[model samples]
Target: MAGGHIEGWSPESLEYLDACPVCGARTGQELLYHGLRDKFQVNTPGAWDFYRCGACGSGYYNPRPTPESVGRLYEAYYTHAHTAPLEYAQLSLLGKLRRILGNGYRNYRFGMHERPASILGILAVWLMPDQRALLDTGGRHLPKQPKGRLLDVGCGNGDFLLFAQRAGWEAIGVEPDPKAVEVARARGLTVHLGTLETLHEAPESFQGITMNHVIEHVHHPRATLEHCYRLLKRGGWLWIETPNLDAQGHARYGENWIGLDTPRHLVVFTDRSLLRLLEEVGFARIERLPYCPLCERVYGMSRALAIGASPHQSPPLPREERVLARQAEANARRRPEIREFIMVRAWKG
Candidate 1:
């Protein structure tokens, strides 16, 4: 970062970030990223080095800013929740639910080129077959979504919350980004301006929680998960999504895999290592969902764009590749992948 800190950065200011977040144990050198903070690149600037506990595999962001420093970065750039209204809430939840329940979006249901594939993709996600039988999703095992008091940590623009809201659950979000918070609030949802470590929780309170793509950014993933465990009611579900380290994406692009957005996405998880971390942390009933083509597309494009294309622009996929994505979504729905990966689901039993 300048071999120097930013406006609010101070030496020893955020030294705590370097240790294993989940276990509070000292860690060793882990994966490092250089383009995370490059404004003009796919990722931003700052050389990011993540640390992992040899004992528990709990990872942390070392030489990383303390929670407060992370707070400042988030405050400056993220305002989705407070931004001008995007009418996001108006249709997302019901739209998603209809896809979940059946029928599809009211306005776009009849016909559209993308609609069929999108509908197929949606059906594939919500109704994937497990061992030949359809699997129940969204943790519907609960009685009435349970007023679950769900928390979407780093709930970007509250996209997930929009659905949780329509499901009639009490959903609250905690995001370090003010811009995202602004946009979420603009959608009529309440969100807090802060990071997970800075959040104040009423112990043993929530029925279920989700950390979609948020785990990788925390300095201490284990500690963060533990905090989540403590906050949940016994047997509560904690659904989390993050990039898989073992994927071909990293092999194909090395440090440039848009997935490795350093400084921000500090820790990466693989199925094997992730399982060990979960078991060590007290989670059970773990499962890995198949990966979507979006993972490769997004990361590859980000990497390609980082060198030349606009950072905000998504990398273009060939027409044939796009068609393949649709087919993958459809087939994966009917049969889950044996290799390609996605989200990891577990229970805090």
Candidate 2:
């Protein structure tokens, strides 16, 4: 899907990649997914050629920008032009409707449409159930009564922090976006403005730490994790949520998939790669759960739309469309597990 016209000249700001995130042997380059030039990526054709690393199962955009130059890709074009609203609006709607519909309906139902979740929030649930369950879970298997502090990396508008606060946890958000931090702060959320790398304040400080979908955007994941390790209390949890190439949508969309919003996504993850990462950085009790249904539906529909196959593409409806629609509806009714998340809990041991 990444094979577009590739127009924009993303200045060649390449830098040496530190040792392989995995293997650490410096020889980790294998192309696992080759993309076909689709209408989705019909841009410069000269910009970025994307590929996957076979050694570690990570997807990346080649001719990649240096960490600093990455800001070049975050312009309005990248923000508004690249984002799809229907999906997120749908999620926000579901979240508001949680009352009439109820939340725990899933703990009992097998495959009903999942109550909508911010991908980041859902990933938070999967990675730190003990944290998320404080609200959703009726206290079974919950971590000892919540206490201490929590840092929401890339905390966005502080929705998750507010949720945490409701659950009796001391929560604060660390967001680099001033506008976002302002919004969260308006909601009375405690937000710090700065990157975690520059924050020289703690060692084993937090009870839990989370970086939701923001790790891929950072310039230094290794350096970032080093801080996460320092900020967490012993036997604490580090929840970092990045896209999982192992999901079915990546297979369906190939490159043009918005999930792989190249240059922007920067570093995509797979189960093995994340586990390897956690261990290398001294995290333990790592768990990987890929809730495929949610990612598949959101990313799949976006990919479909990109390729003129979605209902939004103005393409005429087909007989198969009816069947596919029925299947989607039925599947939604079945409440198939949709999210794919990696939960890594580290004990001071």
What lDDT tens digits, residue by residue, belong to model 2 across residues 201-260?
Answer: 578878888777787777666777878888888877776656666644455456655556
Candidate 1 yields a Cα-based lDDT of 0.58
Q: State residue 43's C-alpha deviation in candidate 1, in Å.
A: 10
What is candidate 2's TM-score against the reference?
0.67
Q: What TM-score, to 2 decimals, does candidate 1 have?
A: 0.68
RMSD values, in order shown:
7.2, 8.5
Model 2 stretches with alpha carbons more than 4 Å out: 1-25, 31-46, 75-144, 289-292, 308-348
Number of the top candidate by lDDT? Answer: 1
Q: What's the CA error at residue 177 for candidate 1, in Å?
A: 2.5
The digit string of per-residue lDDT tens for model 1 on 1-349 reads 1133533346755563434555444545344343245333323335444444565453334566666566544544433433333343465865655443332321122221222124444454345444112222333222343466888888888876775666556888898777787788888888888877678888877888888678877766778888888888887877776766555555545555555555566566665666767788898678764333354355436456446665456667667646655554455445432223446667876
For each candidate, the alpha-carbon lDDT, in order, equals 0.58, 0.56
